[model samples]
Target: MPSGPWKNLSADFCGPLPTGEYLFVVIDEYSRFPVVEIVKSTSANETIPIVDKLISIFGLPKVIKTDNGSPFNSHAFKEFAENTGFHHRRITPRWPKTNSQAESFNKPMMKAVLAARIERRNWQQEPFKFFRQYRGTPHPSTGFAPFSLLFNRETRTKLPQVPTYKPNAVDECARQNDEVAKRKMKQNATFNNSPNDIHCGDVVLMKNEQKNNKLAPNLDPKPYNVVAKKGGMVTVSSTSGMEKNVTRNTSCFKRIPNTLAPGSVEPEVAEGEELILERKDEQVPISDSKSMPMQNAAPTLAPETIPKSKPTVQFSDKRTTPASNVTEPYITRSGRIVRKPAVF
Candidate 1:
């Protein structure tokens, strides 16, 4: 997670609510400020525009976290990340907790959406109300409204105006927040057995992330023997002597004990080919976002979609060629050479 506002953002598909539509939910990791856009599709094509909308409002993020869903895994998104100069990191399949920040808010948000549906209110209007309440209220963990954390000011709402609260309240809130987090961590530690660091020759079961295929196994049938460990990443090769070697994030695999029955052997795979999604390095040109720099006085603009259009290029300079039939003289910036009357 980034330590500053808008430095790192995580996005995920929210729903097929009553409308059968999805919401593209993006949150600033540092401030917890959320942006939930009602969207028609969750495909790469739809996601790129919504991401661009976020950039235009809050400036560009340095990194984006996403799942291995097709929207984030597409080649087009890889190109978009390269163009924006942001690293795109994908969380492991079946590991929603890795992206807890977004997922935590998502639960409450969906609950709100569902409640709106049950109340028979125009659910379409519920998202804005949720956004206002969520941003205006102080977060228990940070003891600050997400709006204040992100914008350094109170969101102007219908509530009565009041003086700034005391510093003691902020300090006490921080202490309470720390206590809550510690208690939660202690409870999780009771049942959570963090995986011991893996090493070369250790058999591991890789996640089978094949989409649209219900017949696929949850874990790949053949276990792979890790060949190397690089901090939080590992490179592994199949134990059956097949060439289906791959490098994936540490969370994407589970250690497979030898006591289990030997799995069916997998067919040989190409050396450079990959069975799952992995980060790709690419480069492309990108224009800077329209958002003002954070150091400047922030503008009071609501986050919304802005249509993009291809720039129209017009050249005022004209070209001259000596091979042409016409006898026009070349012009210079200083002055077209005053030519003596042609003595034809």
Candidate 2:
């Protein structure tokens, strides 16, 4: 949880709406309060103004988390972050769970738009009404309304209520509720953890998520060496001597068994030294093989033990014309052209 309201924020672009406008959404990590701006574009210029306006109303946030979209990755956004004195952090590509606050809000926000369209109401105006109700309602995790958590006052709504002013009590209650909710979520999710056998330095094959064909293996054919393991995330480096290094959730990698031990380095062979292979119960030196007698060699298989070879069938040469005066081309019923092999 954030230290205070507006300290940590998550921002995301929702869509090209019915009017072709995108919703720039900003969510407060602590309060879960959202501020959305329907804009013509999601460029850095448009995003900066919406965030700047929000910063003026609420204090400047310490950190703003967003996906690696063009707006967030642009030089203009970087400059804005530097000027505003906030760290602009980006979530992992293709992973939206890192920015859970904004992503979670987007579902309901879109649902409100859809609901409005079905009811024959203005879609644009319906989101503001939805936000009002959402802000006033008590959150499941926090057990306090977003408006109350952010402003330390109860929001006015259609429902009748007695005005209560206890900012300290609200904060304490929200903190306890948040902790309890997080604990329950973690307990339920612990079963999906990475395999215990996977460890640092183990050889692993990553999941092939972008396979082009059904015949492709589920895991990548190329093996990678695990360099680091942190909780559910694993860092792997390419073992094929390529400069590929990636960090992904542990579930993405499949461990290889009966391979080299972790942190164990193979002894390097000296230049011009041939690699030696030793067979069980037979200690033979490959370099000294020429000196060994033929009598010491393993016995050849008995005639009966060897399988008999099939008789070879000879084909007539193409140059040798057929005995009959038939002038038909050689062709199979399936339309395949057939020709007799020429005798050398």
Deviating ranges (above 4 Å) for candidate 1: 163-344
lDDT of 1 by residue, 1-344 (tens): 46788898888898876667998889888889999888888888989988987898789888899888988889999999999888999999999998888899998888787888889887778768888999999988888889988987788889798867555787899999999999999789656957566777778888887745877678877678899998778998877676877999888888866666276443554554423211133121112233322343332222221213322323466543223232323223442222223221
Give the range of the ten consecutive residues with the poorest summed lDDT in model 2: 298-307
**Which pairs in model 1 have colliding backbones?**
none
Task: Show where candidate 2 strays beyond 4 Å.
Answer: 166-344
Q: So what's the TM-score on candidate 2?
A: 0.48
Clashes of each: 0, 0
Give the per-residue Cα lDDT of candidate 2 at 140: 94
Every candidate's lDDT: 0.75, 0.79
Question: Per-residue lDDT of 214-300 in model 2, one digit per residue for the tens?
Answer: 898898777788999898889999876687689998889888863543444645545545334333442223333333224334322
Per-model C-alpha RMSD: 37.7, 25.7
